[model samples]
Target: EAGRRNLLGLRFPPKYGGRGLRWEDEIVAIGRTANTASLNADGLGIKLGEHGEVHVNASLQTTIPHIYAIGDVIRGAGLAHQAMAEAELVVEALQGAQVDATSLIVPACIYTHPEVATVGLSEEQMRAETDAVIVGEFPLRASGRAVTCNEVEGWVKIVGDKRTGKLRGVHIYASHASELISEATLAIAQGLTIDQYVKQVHPHPTISEALGEAGWVALNKPLHVPRIQRKRLRK
Candidate 1:
């Protein structure tokens, strides 16, 4: 039945057997993009789960104050593009470009049937790592493409540092997780807060717009997802 359902290519997974295991379209897109990007998984082997971090090939620097490292050696997602970006950043810094590597945020893509992509930290990770963390999620049901394609079964989750009100992470379980995560990555990298994102208008009926909605939801002004609605009662 699962095979049949998968073969049928239904937007949702089979309910009889795979009940509750809703396939995320965002994960599917992540995997597809990862494959096209030629990011091999054999080297990484899923050693890290969201916050997994490890440093490899360390060497002290005489001219520079900090040590230099590169490649999949540094723990986290083992995508080549990310590695290349790090390499470039380091090279630029070494050349006295005054680049800031601390602000770089990497995006993750699962690329499964439904697709799953995330940047920075997950809600689970935030809870485990920080005491002051606020999370907000918005469903893809508000997206017109999802409704038009009959594939609106996922959501976007944003994790923010409550103390600083900075976006720490963004996770999405939708049709195009890979593409949608870029905006979130940029926001987190730039230390943009939820309130700032809310002011930016996103085009209607788009999955990317869900990111904006999620940002609003984090700050208590959710749209499309009524469950998290924030209302100020009259005193």
Candidate 2:
């Protein structure tokens, strides 16, 4: 049954996120990504870590101080957006603005059949960092958008600090997880709590709505999933 549904989806991809995209004009590849840093500062004598990634300071400077390194050359998620953010920070530092080279809000995504997108701390990482944590999940099966697309195999999970109600992370496994995660990244980066996040309205009949629903589930004021299930979501 799962196989049939997946094959059907591949044959006729749904226009998720309200875009008029077509699978007929797409190229697909399957493989593991082995990304390495691009370093050309050899003659300049740049210091490298054990893994050979360039070592930089809070200002993204090499051991030489005058030199700077950003993007894949440094230890990070090796994402283009991350590299761009680092570049912007570097430019600000050069202009004498206070900047933090480290501590980037890098969101990751696996662009597969059921895309995986996430930002902020994971449940395990959150548990280790904070004393209290709560997780709220909204299954794709419960989403009206998912039902319309006939692809309801994944879920959206939200992690938050129970004490402060501040949203810690957003993890999504759905068709347009990549497209849906930008909002989550902003929320986590700005340190918006569940209370603040849920106050913003999500449009009806959309996959993004599941994120708000997950927040509601976390606050024990769920409007989509079973109310009793919210208890087991906390740690």
Candidate 3:
């Protein structure tokens, strides 16, 4: 079983949960990953689906018994953090633990300058799925810390259900946006309301404060952006 388990590994360079490139031409031989199943998966009794992803049950187990799959082999954003979470979940499952899918809130981050990060539904997605939606967007120009670091070039937008006040999604486009999104992910995972999120008292003058500002803006109780800007924003 140990040898078979080793054969199931389709990952390369485990330091990160990402796809390894494969060249079709005979000129090169590379390991494929993320969207494609291992070359040996079919012969080993595993099923492949869209984009050549490994098919798994609700328990994350593959078609073959005792052979679970996770990380890039499964369907997801191919993110390292998400893969790590899946790894932990697989471990728990093997240990006879039962967990709900909602227990996992996978946050996506892009490590570029003025990084990009997001979690949960988008405004368009939320609008289509719910009756009413409200959005609060705060820009970096309003962040004192952004000015201090000369990184004022983006905004944070939060979407919520107007009736329930529950946050539907959180999007960030700013410096350290990747780092700032964790709090938003946690809020969404816990179903925190916009009011509850805003009242948390973010530390003064940091990019993270924008999250609180966005929540306040969503509630129509402006914190730092002011009424004049709010009026202009609506226009």
Candidate 4:
């Protein structure tokens, strides 16, 4: 049945087994399943002592100021990009640039089917922390480029601070979402407002426009999605 569904390019409903799992959850499930099957998992590593990771301060300095740590050894998502960012922070600090390492926004991406990528807080997290949150979403099905590529399987979501109009997060679940997330990461990291993001002109009929469209939707100024559809998304 699953094979037939795949052959027909049809996905089962989530209740039966469609795309129901979050990217992180899927990774954990794969690791656990691999362990159960006694497979040599790529993530298997040395079980370090109780104080495994060397704790770092805002300046990336370890508990002992003289020592410093970065990359996978630190308590982070362990992505190469994160390591590179931390490395730059450390270099700036060394050069007496007065860097604040904690301010860095590390973007994460899961390169799965209909890639998942995100930067900053999620809707759930933002809602829990603050009531004044605005969410805007652009379904890929409405995107010209997505339809052209026949990869309109997901959406792009932007979470903003309603009171401040500052972009708080950007999440994408679509083809090339990993690449699309960088723009959002920059927006969030630089504290760009929704207006600022939307004002910039995005090339027509491109996946990148999804981000801009989402920004407009959050502000209740959608251009592509009909009013009825907008209302449904707001709900």
Error of 4 at 111 (Å): 0.6
Compared with the true structure, all predictions reach lDDT values of 0.66, 0.82, 0.78, 0.78
Error of 1 at 10 (Å): 17
Ranking by TM-score: 2, 3, 4, 1
Report, for all candidates in order, the number of backbone clashes: 17, 1, 0, 0
Model 2: per-residue lDDT, tens digit, 28-105?
A: 665333233455456668877766788888889888987888887788777888899999998998898888866678
TM-score of each: 0.67, 0.80, 0.79, 0.78
Stretches of candidate 3 off by over 4 Å are 1-39, 226-235
lDDT of 1 by residue, 67-168 (tens): 455545455466777778878877886787766554567787988767999889877787787778777777666667788889877878888888888888
* Cα lDDT for residue 173, candidate 4: 89
lDDT of 4 at 118: 94
Evaluate residue 192 in candidate 1 and report its C-alpha lDDT on the 0 to 100 scale.
Answer: 88
Best-to-worst order by lDDT is 2, 3, 4, 1
Off by over 4 Å in 2: 1-43
Predicted model with the maximum TM-score: 2
Backbone clashes in model 4, listed as residue pairs = none
Single out the weakest 10-residue window by summed lDDT for candidate 1.
31-40
Clashes of 3: 0
Report the Cα lDDT for candidate 2: 0.82
lDDT of each residue in 59-116, candidate 3, tens digit only: 7888996998778887766677877788788888889987444367788887877799
Error of 2 at 86 (Å): 0.8
Q: Candidate 4 lDDT, tens digit per residue, 1-97?
A: 5554433234557522375332212223422111112311123432222335445778888655655678766666778998998999888888887
1 or 3, greater by lDDT: 3
